[model samples]
Target chain A: METTETLNETQLITKDQLLNQWLGQRKVTRRVLDAFPEKELFEFTIGGMRTYAQLTKEMLAMDGATAKGVATGEWSTLDEEKSELTTKADLLASWDESTEKIQKYWKQISIKNFQEKVVAFGQYEGTGYSILFYVMDNEIHHRGQGYVYLRALGITPPNFWEQY
Target chain B: METTETLNETQLITKDQLLNQWLGQRKVTRRVLDAFPEKELFEFTIGGMRTYAQLTKEMLAMDGATAKGVATGEWSTLDEEKSELTTKADLLASWDESTEKIQKYWKQISIKNFQEKVVAFGQYEGTGYSILFYVMDNEIHHRGQGYVYLRALGITPPNFWEQY
Candidate 1:
């Protein structure tokens, strides 16, 4: 509400720390994706839920592009229509590409820029920090589902807390 | 990172909008909680995964306490190793309390304070904004697991995007 007149210097965190945290979560999520058995990754669903492959694609479609939009001030419409990712190896490769894109574009965003807002993907409008957080959140959300899928298939998932 | 010095006026959104967006996701997560059958909610697990009830409690432990900490500079340690909640209704009631607490404490946080950092729950040091975003992200992540549990139990989960 603007009542706090002076900026609090003690509370500030370096931009590097924030970005690293987000990237750490991404690393854990990629492991979640890899835990899935190849067949189940694309075929397993309970009660009409989408497969882990589909969910991964949904995450892939947004994260890199959203960060790019935030960094460059350009918003492009995305095609939500996705084809099946037939193999786990292929999906993992695509996930690696997205992670690289995030690292590359992340350098373009300044700490002050995180407070700025943008209409991400030509739709939802929010601060750069909020939108980027959504992408990260969305990945974690889907990864949770992947954990469930792994369990259902009688496979143990990678530890959830070992992101770093 | 500060090389692009020109101010971008169009990329801005109010704090209220950001909070509402987070609340909208929380609403859908509540619906996910509702979809679970009582017995399965607490007991169902695959490959030794935590029950959906456990995941929900983990979320509850963080959200309300987090907002309180960000609003004020103090954080109270939560007892995570507590006993069972016993009933679905009781769990949901506790969840409602946490949600209400978030709303109440959110007002205490000033916009400028979001940039300030804090060590949330005696760990995970990050900015107020990043910490709050983690709370929201953690909820979404666990909620995704709930969706999987529902599906595995032969129940149809609510639409994911219907949160907004």
Candidate 2:
């Protein structure tokens, strides 16, 4: 397979940009959650699937694990039991906690540390780089679903490209 | 604003897993696209944003525009003109083209490349990253919107996290 070389040595992103991106993602997620009716959240699905609320619960579980990984710098050592977040408030609280944890951990990352190889668990073993991609990607994948859920309920989510 | 580090290394992601993740995203997108009513696609918005069709057009415009900074590589360029995509077929075709391009580029990336900084175009400013987290995140973010749109139309997307 042909491999592309890295971009020229450039500090392309600053701490502020990263922070803004994370915050923006959280903001969108909050809006999506707020727009849905509580009853519909658990029942809405295309095809045979769990509702958005179920997905939120799953996210809450993962956030707890990811937080542990970030706090200790040990991704492979985190537990995998599903955490139950039964209410929207619980989900939001969990989201806030995870966001705080992620923010704290992001600050500790240096440009050099991104390149360092590390082991990752869940859905086949992978490196730190790939694992991090999974974390962010998973959130996005579900967020898109939230939009569909919102539209079904006649609510429009904020623009995907807009900041704040 | 704090930045945190991922504990897992980059080497853990296998090619199969990466492909699976990409495929899964496409599947979810397709489901959302299928649910849209042709009439509502162009003007639909949640929270005062453009509809999925509008978003798709924006994605299409990124291709073949050097100034738009969405061209294959070249991250320093910037273009502000928003191109219009006339039909769903055109938008879908453009989406197909972009996905192919993205896959082609992604295949060229290796474990080592994930850690290197990359200046990706098509954002507020030409920002860079060691990992392609933003790209995947961007896709997922939009995909989530598709889900909401589907819900609003009383259509359900397939179970995204389910194993076939």
Tell me the TM-score of each prediction against the true structure: 0.77, 0.59
**Which candidate has the top score in TM-score?**
1
Off by over 4 Å in 1: A1-18, A72-85, A107-131, B1-18, B81-84, B110-130
Task: Choose the strongest candidate by DockQ.
Answer: 1
For candidate 1, what is the TM-score? 0.77
CA deviation > 4 Å runs, candidate 2: A1-9, A14-16, A67-73, A76-83, A110-113, B1-55, B63-93, B96-138, B145-164
For model 1, state the Cα shift of residue B3 in Å. Answer: 27
After the best TM-score superposition of candidate 1, give how far the Cα of residue B23 lies from its true spot, in angstroms. Answer: 2.0
In terms of docking quality, model 1 is acceptable
- Write out the backbone clash pairs for model 1: A11-B117, A117-B11
Looking at candidate 2, what is the lDDT of residue B40? 74
Model 2 lDDT, residue A19, Cα: 53
Candidate 2 residue lDDT tens string, B1-164 = 01222312322234444555665665566556656777777676665656788665544444323212222345544332335556666667766776666656555544334334344553444332322434546656776666666656667666654412
DockQ per model, Cα = 0.35, 0.21
